[model samples]
Target: MLDYLKKSFARKKARRQFQEYSHTVSKFILKEEGEIAFANWNNPLVTPKVISQEEVNFFKKFIPKGALCIDIGTNIGDTTVPMALAAGKTGTTIGFDPNPHVYKILEENVKLNRDKTNIAPFPYAITKDEGEFYYHSSEASFGNGGISNEIVSDQGAFQLPQKITGINLEKFLEKNYRALLPKLSFIKVDVEGADKEVIGSIGNLLTKYKPVLVAECFTRATSEERAELYNIVADLDYTLYYFSDFDENAEIIKLEGPKDMNRWKTFNFYAIANAE
Candidate 1:
């Protein structure tokens, strides 16, 4: 074991090198079950990105330990696993992902971390309703983590069979708000370009739970479409916080007036919650 660890850490290479030996990486994490599961770009389905120190601390402050956390784009359980750890044995984590390739690896990581008991894995995409959609599979395309491009497959972005788990977030809240609500802590949404739909579905919960929302906004979206989304959240009365990357400190950003409608290429994340 000592020798293996030494060898694995001795030679450092490009991030993609781990992709060649994904199985090996899987084995390493799987060897110790119940330990915190962590993954990187090698996983392909979910790649770990550097989050800002302030953001980490923010979660520490607001995301209570042993609170139920929901991960929308679980990918490979990067945030899901940590959420489980943060919640501890008493807490529960629910992860949702539609990509079969990513879901398989997410389950593997869940087992690798021995979080199967604490985390419930859902293999489906969270959309406004149940319906068919297309996804892109690209090894080269970076960013726009969710379904950014059109359903059309090109440049190796194949349109695989996908079904949206028509989840009326409001209804889910009405059903589980009392029975399963866990302090209703942190919520992360990075579903490519479907942010509008996902948020729309959770209209009531956003108001009831009032959890800190980490949402990714597609800057390239049409001016009108962006305005609609901004208005939806505005009506909810959430203070917007911007996070370009996880590691930087979150800054308060004012939303444009109801009439200001302009399109930008920068994707901004808003950390919205009650003022007090």
Candidate 2:
């Protein structure tokens, strides 16, 4: 009876907040776990969407054996685990996710695959500087959001009150993952909408290592922002491939130039540095 009343009250309050604020209330406590999850944006019902998948095989084909890889915004370690496994026990896959709610689950998943996969999880947002900053959640609910940009929804208050530190990815890797730099052959960035900033912060590494890059051009981002993503990678001599789905078999639309990007929909794109 007590638990029922409590849950009933919570639901009523949630509805009230949704109606009043427009954006769903951000709930920080998240429970349960899944092998895979979709880090969707503007979801008021949940922060990270969970689904069942016994195996993650999409990244194995992209990640070479015994090669180092990195996954930014690794919600629940879904992509991170596969990258780690693909890299083999001899290699390492470092994942960075600042969302504490999901980061906890990622940490647990990392442990479960420790025996067979080399994984490292960090609860920090990737940025150009090493300092504390605000982490905002747009259209959030019970734990979901993308990027720290102050994008307001139809609801009044979309930015949640949370602080996450920014880590200089290049410096962090140089200081810690130095030994593995030579083997850094793959990098995947799915940080909502800050893909370019993350890429820019590590520009030197990308230039030096010339790793395979996979980044999401977020649906909420502006056209210029998406175009810049193209310019950044193209300047580095990468051939771009855009795909709508995460499936390895999904049809790919090759991007010939900046004008070809269709930002009306959400998509993940990949690029390979032209072999020197």
Candidate 3:
């Protein structure tokens, strides 16, 4: 009876915490310009700290008007919306988020901007192979949710585990998006620590379409893992550029070597297939 009471108390506390977080998120959203909705109240992206204005400007500069783009980790349409708007009516933007909990919000955000942004949201995790995988749902922050393939214990909030479908990027593209492959212009990938796997899965497409890739490189990744990821893009003859901070006027430094990158906990960088 005592144990039961303890569990009940814990549950109540958690509920209260969640409620407070939700209210804070709502307040934050009210200040934003766009009609952005979030399924998870604790989603880090809901806070302005997560989305930087410079990052938005960088994406806008690269993702041309009327271009087909892919947002690997849409995260409630923060970057996806801008990509869609930049793509314009003649272009298409496909956003993917495996987290079912947050996917609903992604869909809602896309719908909210339907008239202005041509963005499609898919709730499937992209992987090197097509199969089932456990996705660690983070109770603390939406940004921390990641695949179970690698032991990601640091997933914030550490919520219940969920089984998510992993789609093979190459196969999915060939089967359904083959016609749109050649038209692919940009791909923004921010799949937590699964950056290598995500990039590897789309190796063929990277070579064929040569779309500009914007990937998040987590400092937690081992030097070897980073090297392999760098080689993957380098082998395909892509030039690397790094965005060390959120300064809009900051120059996108050309990464000549691995040592060039500022080892921030998580940093966004770009890889252009063909560069002068």
- On TM-score, the candidate that comes out on top is 3
lDDT of 3 by residue, 1-276 (tens): 999887666555553343223322221232222443323334333444344444445566767767789999776666786677667667889989887656766776665545556877788889887777766644433434787655466654454345778888778767877777778889989888788788888988888888999898776787777777777778778998887643457657787866654455567788988754
TM-score of each: 0.70, 0.77, 0.78
Q: How many clashes in candidate 3?
A: 1
Ordered list by lDDT, greatest first? 2, 3, 1
Error of 2 at 120 (Å): 0.3
How many clashing pairs in candidate 1? 10
Superposed by TM-score, candidate 2 places the C-alpha of residue 67 at a distance from the truth, in angstroms, of 1.4
**How does model 2 fare in lDDT?**
0.70
**Pairs with steric clashes in candidate 3:** 140-157
How well does model 3 score by local distance difference test? 0.69
Residue 7 lDDT in candidate 2: 67
Winner by lDDT: 2
lDDT of 2 by residue, 91-186 (tens): 889999887766866776676545557888999889887877656554333244454444445323445467677899888998998988999989
* Residues 1-276, model 1: lDDT tens digits: 998666555333322232232422322222222333344434333344432334334455555667777888887665676556556566667788876656765777666545333777886667676555555544422212345334555423444555334355555655755676737787777776677778777767777778777776665567777677677777788765544454335554555543333433645556566575
- Candidate order by decreasing TM-score: 3, 2, 1
lDDT of each: 0.58, 0.70, 0.69
